[model samples]
Target: MYIATYIIDIAALIYLMGLLYSNAALNTSRKKPFLIAIILTIVIILSEAGTVLTNNGSLNLRGINIVCNVLGFILTPMIPIAITLIFSRMILTTHKLLLISTFINIVATALSPIFGFIFYVDANNQYIRGDYFFVFIIVYIINLLILVIITLEVGKTNNYPIIGKLVGLSIFTIIGTSIQIVYPFTYSSWHCVTLSLLLYFF
Candidate 1:
């Protein structure tokens, strides 16, 4: 089931790399962050898949599962941060507020194994959400909100033609993410993100 989706993600990653290598404009500083976002998306996809596999693998695999889950939680929100940077015309320092959620999420996720603040795997090798599972959800939402605001602002200020496309993409992402949040086993969000990245490229 997930194998097909992940295969598509790999195909898109390769396709995007081919496009980026051939297109000089996409390799410029202004557009480079999108490439970074693509790379991050690939990492998240792999981590998510690992989490799923390790969830039922073996007791000895618990450590690997925890690592994959932590990586996914920490990096998932950062994709939006990367997208936000791609649309920014100011210095990187100006995006401090935009990064707060990601920083908080990283801390919470890192401490989860000991504190179980974000998530934990059970004695049965089953993955379980901790008291602060919402922390990861909120962080993802906040990062996406910041991305949308910056995208709109950039379009408005520069009269760029990105507002409609980005707005539509944001809606698409939100719906897909919301579905995954509601139905944890669905595995739709990352695939939506991969499609969004490919769409944005075109």
Candidate 2:
């Protein structure tokens, strides 16, 4: 688990390094989307840190626990959103389905802390899964399905200029997300996301 965790942290760190080294070219059309992804990746690092500490069961700080849970819950949905945004220009639109679904997720996450609709921390500060825990899974599945459908229907193809990179990003990200959803115990999504975005940028 720690191995996976450190590897993801390193992946995210390498992305940060890209900003320093690749800024010359990234300063063009890629600047906005690249910065958005970089910011989201940094947040994923924090979210993964929270998950790590929670699983460790050593630093049982209630406030930190709650804060981490809320942030992690809120941030997870945004990765797909940011990724979609990065690819929007290429796809020719803002992607109504992705935008709407992600917006719903954002709204639900905002209410989670208050209503515990998704998850809540107890007095002990231990992470507690909520009744609507499956909501997260459902949302992610929808996002991936929409992405795949788009990829097949209208996404850039093998003959297209950026086909290989987009195909690689979509496949790897879906696999990583599926693993995290099925296991719900492994901390691998962030690394996969980092890799996907890195593929996009470079």
lDDT agreement with native, every candidate? 0.84, 0.67
> What is candidate 2's lDDT per residue for 53-169, written digit by digit as tens?
764365556666666766777677766655665545543365554556666766776677678778776665556677887787788777676665555444544345766567667
Task: Output the number of the TM-score-best candidate.
Answer: 1
* Local accuracy of candidate 1 as per-residue lDDT tens digits, 1-202: 8977898897898788678878876547646887788888888888998998889789999998999988988888888778777778352676676677778999999999888888988777788899999999999998888878878888899898768988888778878878998999999998898888887778
Q: What is the lDDT of candidate 2?
A: 0.67
Task: Give the per-residue Cα lDDT of candidate 1 at 141.
Answer: 92
Off by over 4 Å in 1: 89-91
Q: What TM-score do all the candidates reach, one by one?
A: 0.94, 0.78
Q: How many residue-pair clashes does candidate 1 contain?
A: 0
Instruction: Supply the TM-score for candidate 2.
Output: 0.78
